[model samples]
Target: MEHQAIDELPSGKICPQKPPKNFVLLVSVLLLLTIVQLYHPSIFRSLFLSKTIDSNPQVPSTSSSSSSDHSNVQEDDLPSITSNLKCDIFTGEWVPNPEAPYYTNTTCWAIHEHQNCMKYGRPDAEFMKWKWKPDDCELPVFNPAQFLELVRGKSMAFVGDSVGRNQMQSLICLLSRVEYPIVVSSTEDQRFIRWKYTSYKFTLAAFWTPYLIKSKQVTYTEGPTKNGLFELYLDEFDEAWTTQIDEFDYIILSAGHWFFRSMVYYENQTISGCNYCLIDNVTDIGKQYAYRKAFRTAFKAINSLENFKGITYIRTFAPSHFENGMWNEGGNCLRTKPYRSNETRLEGLDLELYKIQIEEYRKGEREGRKKGLKYRLLDTTQAMLLRPDGHPSRYGHWPNENVTLYNDCVHWCLPGPIDTWSDFLLEMLKMEGMRSAEEKKLRITNDTTLN
Candidate 1:
């Protein structure tokens, strides 16, 4: 100790380790800093390391009067329907069948209520007697031209099976009255087909998800509700369908036809593919359950993301029946005149499926609300179930006399009854108010989260 005489350490220099009275204090301070670095790295980073976090400045609050005034101004800014004429053609009653002017062989058809029931038949007629009768339950006739007014330049996608294609074609035809020319794509899937009218852009597309989940299109025929072998296509739901679709302002989906196909799958994995012809040992894979599960799956993906800000309108099931004997049995569709509006009726498993879908829809609404997602269902299934007279049966199929034209009631002719489905969609869009309600709903949802 004498020799070290405290080899006096220089100012600000570390002295040789000889337990000093304050050594424990120094160790304690070091240990506290180590704990801070381990537990609160950000604090250390901010103090020693150069780190910065960007933040937005606080926004000024608006007064209640200003908000009220803004709403009033918005109301004033809404486009007036002065130029729009109320067309009563949809409400016209069915006129008596016209005589076949020329010797021809075509059966005309029109949708009644919603079912594919027959109206009347004519042995000779160039045009089918299709009356645009409007009913109490029928949706109002919305002008497609008017709809495209605000939706111009926006992409609208209809995701589902063949029924979705029917909707696409119907929408395209409805908007044809406007000066715009429609460009339809060749392949189904996520192809681009456009309708250009002024500032509005209407893109009619088919995502071709038979089950809207993982159903495949195969060669074999399965029973009425279960058919088609599609194990190969069920792997990627988002990648196969949703990956390419984005920035959509409106989305319409329908997919009941595929449930009747041969096979259904949950993924690349097969669920079941029952034969359509034989009804024995049939699996209980109802379309309703499949649709609901898939719909919920879709909403979960949509709601989890912040960018999806659009209105999703789901068009319910479209009815199909060939059992009454396929136009030859008691089911004759050789009609030149449209059937009475109130005479339409629906039956069989189709009706049961329709009811189940409605229930699923209600469940979907609840799910969407809980997740801050906006999904609306267009209940056109009941409306379509009543329109049996609308089939092109015999009429659409038989272009020439003595030839059977409209035998199958599954598919609809162009500009036929399904056109009204598009009309319903347009009116629904309008009732939500002009300027795409989807955007408005999304805006409100986003604002709430931020505030």
Candidate 2:
């Protein structure tokens, strides 16, 4: 063989040199990849080109920038959807709203006869025309559609006294505007009533547990004389509500007036004490003490429930606007307008009870949050205390020719101030729903990033 450099070899006569096996394999692989790139452009782009484009961002066009800026400006102009929107729905003035009294007594059959103040002959209809306006921000009008959407496929219960029933009735009437719910369950005693909106799979029920504690009426008779005694089990929960707590997605509890009534308190089946039990050496613990203990027991039972992912609300005392005398002493709420917060001092048992309820709720809220339960205070006392004109007075019942009726200053009139309670509740629900949704979104994003 003639000695020759590899590059100077003749075209026809090649030097006896073998190509490296690895180098040949590499060239073959490159050729295959080039063919694939020409045949399947998407795969090639995804494997190489797309990553580079994503890594190096391009400047946005003027139109696109302007569009984004406009969207951002629009979002800024709108009210914040966050929970930080600070507005006191409770402490505000009532402004005239021509479209007030979302539902009328005649239109809503749910209204108890006594609450039908408009049907009977309430003179001042102007009281129903006002809407609550927070000093800091405007309250969104109660939208029945929105409320129903938020509570879709959920069950809610009002577990408290007749006042709770009153609130339930107001909510039903408000929701009735969107669609009438069917009464799914009704009993003779009417202690438990359930209304269902089949379209949304929503059930609204009211569980009448007046004291929020087990109670029984005992009668003692001695030779043709009979006396009725009210006995309350301070440590026990009312079965009417306790049995159903696990089924509810939301529960609202209220108790104040019932505690005011005389009762003997028992704990663990033994007499603990008494409120106004006139026996000697059985010291009369103030009604407030009993009230506090009763609420504590109720909260304990509620918080200890298993599989309860529900939110709870403790509605503060709804004050009676009796003036010059008490309920039995011919007192009446005759004003046709709301009281200015500065014009009056909120004192007496109503204010005291309200304060106590709020304090207890705070304690419950702290404890409940630990156990995955949420508790909030529906503080309606302050705003309601201002609306003395919303009471039923003598117009709560139809006129009777032969009988005289005492004025009703305790329960509020339907199609009146009680409707505002629904407004406050709906707003709270909206804010809470927004916060919960935000939390869920954040949790999902974090989980995705981890994956």
Candidate 3:
């Protein structure tokens, strides 16, 4: 066979034919583009044709241990489907966060008088310098502007006790960077306070129902008692909140500290028993019994509301760190730093109350799902249990003032560890938003298939 004629050089090196004009132009253009890309690395992200991943990242850890998507955990919570995926964002540690105390007491007037530790002369500021860091993944720092925009034109309520109010105030202060809320209404006792953001048209309210049920101590002829024994009706809803709850778009329910007070618990309008009353022939049920019932009633009221349509978040109990003595007997929390995981653990009354709240929340979640409602678990117990240093303790008031004063171990200081609760709140909100969109898409697909 005759070999094809080949172009060759005199030195024996293979010689190639001259390239076409179009091919030469293409090679020059490719060489120029490669140089530009090397210099301008971010240019590809802006171009749609580039293979940049425009998708969400998987959450670091979950109860289900599924590393693929958040939907696995959320689908587990949906009543429409049977699921085992569970997300546990609450299990975490306190890493050194230099950018904490995002707002000071001066910047946010929402700081209550009882929690104004910095203004009242807190000796150490290190407690406010750290943030909660989840062990499984990095939690995103709270974005107030993003939070406000997410709930624009909606209303949220904090219904339960003072700690719930503490988290609500943290949220308010966090959002103040975007827009400060104005007082729409308030009660004389500060039990019912409503604030509206003029710019965002968002309303935030707190309805005081320490018992989450109808309760009142028969006061003396003189006036109301500060530490009077309460009569908690376990089966009845506290109209203080239930009457106003239907209007809210979001409600955060929490109750823990108040149940620990000296009290009597009732059911079905009859005297069931007393917690610590030592009454004649009245059975002495434990505080946890009342705590459990209070949560159950709160959840029942939410599920019972026929016209109320909204998302409910149960922010589980935040344990108070009263050490050495009880609050009345000069108890205090004076640590300047967070505890290591090995150094402390969540147990005792705090853990018990947290578990009770969760049990009721899960039961209510199942019931609420039947009404096409949503319920979420905020689960701040484990995180806050490590921060005994976060409370105001004796720093809430002037130590030398000639007046009655008690160490505030139950409430948290402003611009302190409690602010992380708002961080958790915002993160949960993002998750809920994603889950809602997914639910809507699924519903639409189901409807189309039915047709």
User: Over the stretch 1-451, how does candidate 1's per-residue lDDT look in tens digits?
Assistant: 1222344777899877877759767876887788877755434533431111112121111111010000111221122111123322124343332321111112212122122222233233323333233432233343443455546677777777656766675555445444334455654424344433443545545565665554345453445533335432333355455664566777786667555534444444544423333445545555445555665565555555556666677676777644356443545444333435456655676776666666655665556555545566666665455455555565443235454324646655444556666555654454444222334655587689999
> In terms of TM-score, which candidate is stronger, 2 or 3?
3
Please report, as a residue range, the 10-residue window in candidate 1 with the lowest summed lDDT: 64-73
lDDT, model 3, position 415:
88
- Badly placed stretches (over 4 Å) of model 1 are 1-140, 182-199, 218-228, 232-238, 264-292, 296-301, 304-306, 321-323, 326-332, 335-344, 394-406, 434-451
Model 3: per-residue lDDT, tens digit, 1-451? 2333334446767688777889878877887677756644323222321111122131111121111224323443532111113435577789887666678899899998889998998988889888776766556666665566567899999998888888889888877765689888956567799999987799999988888888897642221243577888999988888988898999988878877666777888888887767666678888989988888888889889988999998877888888888877777777778888789887877778877877788888878877888887777877888888888887888887543447787888998888887777766665564466666777688679999
Sort order, lDDT high to low: 3, 2, 1
Best by TM-score: 3
TM-score for each of the candidates:
0.57, 0.76, 0.78
Q: Candidate 2: TM-score?
A: 0.76
- Per-prediction count of colliding residue pairs? 45, 0, 0
Q: Which stretches of candidate 3 lie over 4 Å from their true place?
A: 1-87, 186-189, 219-227, 402-405, 437-451
Q: Write the per-residue lDDT of candidate 2 for residues 216-253, one digit (tens) a residue.
A: 86654321112445788888878777877798899988
